[model samples]
Structures are given as C-alpha cells and as structure tokens.
Target: MDPQNYPSMDQYNYSNNGGNNNNSGYRNQAPQQHQQQQPQQGGGYPPQYNQGYQPQQQQQQYNPNQQYSPEQQGIGMQQRGGSGNEFLISSISSNPLAQVGFSYGQSLFNDGKQYVDSNIGKYFSFSSLKSYFNVNTSYVFNKIKLIIFPFPQKTWKRRIYRVGDVDSYLPPRDDINAPDLYIPLMAFVTYYLLYGFQLGMGREFSPDKLGTAISKGIVGWLIEIGIFRLGSFFSNSYSIPIYDMIAYSGYKYVLMVITIISSILTGGYISFFVKIYLVACLGVFILKTLRVVMVSDNSANSHHDMHQQHEGSAMRNYFVFGVAMLQCVILFFFN
Candidate 1:
C-alpha cells in the first residue's frame, strides 16, 4: 500500500518491451546496410528488385513497334512469294480444258462400261465365237446350239416362246436365243479367211485376190440386203428391221464356210454327199425361219394353203427359196 514498497508499472512495462523494439530495429537496419555494401553480381538484392529486372529484360527483348532486320523482312517476303507461286500453279492445273478432258475420259469409261453390260451375257454373249479372238468355252457351246438348233423346241419338240429360256423362241431383243453380231461377224471373217487359205493353198495369193474376196463379201451383203428388202415388201412383213434381215442372210455364209471347210478337208465323193446334206439343211432352215419372221402370222398354220390361194404370197416364198438355193450354187462355185 505504501508508494516506496510498490513496484512502478512504467518501469516494468519498459523492461519487457524495450528488448523486442531494439531487436526489430536492428533486423531492419542490418538488412539495408547489407544490401548497400553487397555487389549486384552476387544477387544481393530484394525480391521486388530481381522481379523488376526480369520485366526490363523482357521489355528489351520484345517490342511490337520495333523494326525487323532487312534480312528477316526479305525472308518473310520470299516465303509469301513462294506460297503465291504455288497457289498460281495449282490454279492453272485446274484449268477449263483439263477439267473438261477429265470429264470426257470419265464419260468414255462410263460408255464402255455400259456397252459391256449391254453386250455381255451367259448364253448370248459376244464371246460365243472363237473367231472373235477372245471367247469363252461356254460361248462356243451355246453358239453351236444356236447354229444347229435354230428353231426353239422343248424336250418333247414342242415350241416355247418365253424369253431367256434356252429352248424358247427369241423375240429379237432381251432373249438369250436372239441373234447377235458375234456370229455374223465371225462368219464374215471366216469367209474371207477361208478364201485366203484357198488362195494360199492354190499358190495364187495376190493383193488383187484379197480385193476380190472383199468385193465378193461386200456384194453378197448388198445382194442379201436387196433380196431381203424385196422379200420383205412382197411378204407383207416389212416390220423386220434391216439389221435382222442382214443377220438372217449372214447365216448362209456360215453354211458356205462349212462347205468350203468340208471341201478342203474331204476332197472326194464324201464331200459331195456332205454338200447335198448341207444344202438341204440350209433350204429347210431358210424355209422355216422366213416363214415365221417374214411371213404373216395369219398364214403361219395355213402357209401352204395360203401360198396356193395367194399368188403374191407364193411369189414371195418362191423368191426367198430362190435366194436360199442361190447360196448352194454360190458355195460350190466360189469355194
């Protein structure tokens, strides 16, 4: 309770706080002096000062408004020029003529594809004849069937008229039994080839002989066309297209080739018998085929009866028969 005996509060508080204040002041002043005395090479600086140096280096390294070296500018311009040249060359390659040519080639390829699709089939393909240069074995057999069995008949010898049936009457289109250019072309070629062989065998090969052979074939074709036109007019079946008539007439050449081959192979009385049989078969084939296609269906059943009654029809039949017989005589004479 007495002033002398009580400890002073101010003295006690100063003794406790004075040591902390002096230690803190010493820490702050010691760091500043260390920085001023230390060299910059040893990295003796504040964290803020080091950070600020990085920014200054970055500022020096990159400035958007700074001018590039002439060499760098030239390199950039050269790269741009090279890109522009490549673009121009590419644009020229895509020119109108090149594009049109590509389109034309594509169209030709498409047309060829269409032709193959339309002309190639199983029983009635262009590959049916060996003389075609590239033919299938199946085609050869079918062609033999077409030649030997011109008239369609069932197992019982009854006629069938459905399309695509192997033993049915072909309606001239979309029918396996229908005639095509393969056989006729082969026959025509065979005719000339046979004639050429004959000339070669006889030691009479000449360019003139070749010309004669070609002329003969051309004449025969023309004569067949004329005969077909006249026959078509007289028979009242002008509906048969010219090509059909040509194809029909061309069958005679196949018979002629047979006669020539037989003559060449068997040059005796046996050949004569073969020729007679061939002529008879040719006559029958012409009679039956023409009767159906060139003659009216109204008289199909009563064709013999109608021929007797109708002079014009008789004359037409006689004319067609006369043409068929002419082939027999020509086969003997030419070969």
Candidate 2:
C-alpha cells in the first residue's frame, strides 16, 4: 500500500473530532431555529404541513364555570349528526316489507280488539264482577262456616245500598250475606283438585278420568243454572240479573268441595253420609238465599214495600223447594 494514501493517526483523530463537533453544533442549534420560526409559521408547523391543520383554540378558550344554552348543545348534536343505529332504524322503517308487516300487525290487533268488544264484551262486564273478588281471609272463613252450617244465620237478606236515589245491594265485602263468585270459583277449582287427589290415592288417576270429572262438574253447573232460570221464570220472578244467578248457582261447588274432601279424608267409607249432610245444608242454604232474592224488589222501593207482591206465593215456594231438592241429584252426580 502507498503511505500517502492514508493520513497519520493524529491527523485522522483530529478530522473525526471536527466532524463530531459539527454534528453536535447542528443538533444544538436546531431547537432554537425551530423556536424562532414558530411565530412566522403561525402554529409551530411549516406552511406546507399546516395546509388544513387548526389549533384547538376552542379547548384552549373553554372555561369550566361557563354555562351553555340548550341551543348550543343542540347545535353540537346536529353537527355530530346521526349514528349507525339511527341509519339502520331509518332503513328498516323505509323498507316496504317492514312497513307492510307493521301495518298488518296493527290491523290484526285492532280487529281482534273490535271483535272481542263486539262479541263477549256486551254480555260480561268485568268491572261489575270485580266486586266479587274483594273478599279477605276473614270473609272466606266466615263464608265457609256459613256454607257448612247456614242455619245459624237468621238474616239471609242482603244489605241494601240507598244513596242519592240509587238503590243497590252492597257487595260481598261489605255484607256477609251478599252473594259472591270468589268462594264458588275457589271451591270449584278445589273440588276438581281433590277429586284428582282421591283418584291419585286410589292409584286410578288418569287424565281422561280427570277430564271426565271436570266435564261432569261443568254439566252439573249448567244444569243448576238452567234449573234456577226455569224456576225463576215459572215462579214469575224474572227481575234477577243473570250474573246474580250465576253467582248463586256457583255456590253449590263449595259444598261439593267439602264432600270431596270428607271423602278423601275418610277413605270413601263415611263420605256418603257426610255428603248427605252437606247436601242437606247446601239445599237449605240455597232455599233461604234464593227465597230472599225471589221476594226482594231489585228496583226502587221504600223499606216497607221492599218485598214483592208474590213474596209468599205458593208457586215461588214450590220453585224454591224444587231447586233445593235438585241439589241432591247434582251432588250425587258429582260423586
């Protein structure tokens, strides 16, 4: 190698130190130069870099104590605009199939409501029947006692409400003597359950037999209603409401439930005699209660004239007796 091609060691070190000093000087001056050019560039960035850049002057100017108006908030929300969810909802609402489905569902609901209002609504007023369910535990206990042994109660007449020329019978909640559907409904349900339980105890439980039992119960109930309606018609007492008749007819289920329970507890041995006694009690109860309803005037009348013209007529008594005696047939049929 030629000696002149490479420098001496001391000269090489001096050249390297000079290059390092230049690089260090340039690095030290860069920040100062950048600081000096910031005001000219308007935001510490070059003109080319700041083509669309904006400083967050609003954030810098914000004051925590400032109160914003609803108008300002609404404007901000408008600027933010609708999200993906809003767009999807709008799309669905604009769809022809979705619109058609919505219209069809609304029409179906309306048609069903109209049909129900036109058909069964006229015959049954649920609002009036709400009073029948207002019974409490105490009322239920007393009612059960009355059903079992109604002879102790001397007053079978329902309490009358006379306020501002409006005459009506007090609800069962207010008057113990008043007819209610609650006990009857509960007893009816309990009778079926007890009958099923009795079948279960005997290992003879079947859904078919249970259904048969329910059918029999319903038939018996309908028959009783028919008997009452016919008896009222024949006896010349047609002032009673059909709802009242229904409540009255339903009460026999209470005695039926008792008979079933007695049968269950006694293993079907003493049940026959117990059923006879309960049937008799139920018959007496029906006789007395129906007699009062048959005689009392449902329309406007003074206390003296509350009794109808045929209060103690033979036909009325005979009808009442016949209704009472028919309960035995129904009870045995249930068994």
Name the top lDDT candidate: 2
- Model 2 Cα RMSD, Å? 10.4
Question: Could you give candidate 1's per-residue lDDT for residues 1-335 as a string of tens digits?
Answer: 77898778998889879988999999999999988776454376666677545534334467688888898879988999999999988887879887788899999999997777676642234433322233445654665455555556322111356556453433333343344455666788887888789888989989898998799778978886787777667765545555556666776677777777877888798888777776666666666666555344334535456556477566667766776776656656655
Give the alpha carbon lDDT tens digit for every residue of 1-335 in model 2: 99899899999999999999999999999999999876576556667777687677655577789998998879867655666568889999999999999999999999998888789777566677888787888888898899889888899888888999988778787888887888888888988998899889999999999998799878878878877888878767767666778887787788888777787778455988888788888888888888887667333232334255446356778987887777767776656
What RMSD value applies to candidate 1? Answer: 15.5
Clashes of each: 0, 0
- Stretches > 4 Å off in candidate 2: 1-125, 298-312
Computed on alpha carbons, the lDDT of every model, listed in order, comes to 0.65, 0.80
Q: In model 2, what is the error at residue 10, expressed in angstroms?
A: 30
Supply candidate 1's per-residue lDDT for 63. Answer: 66
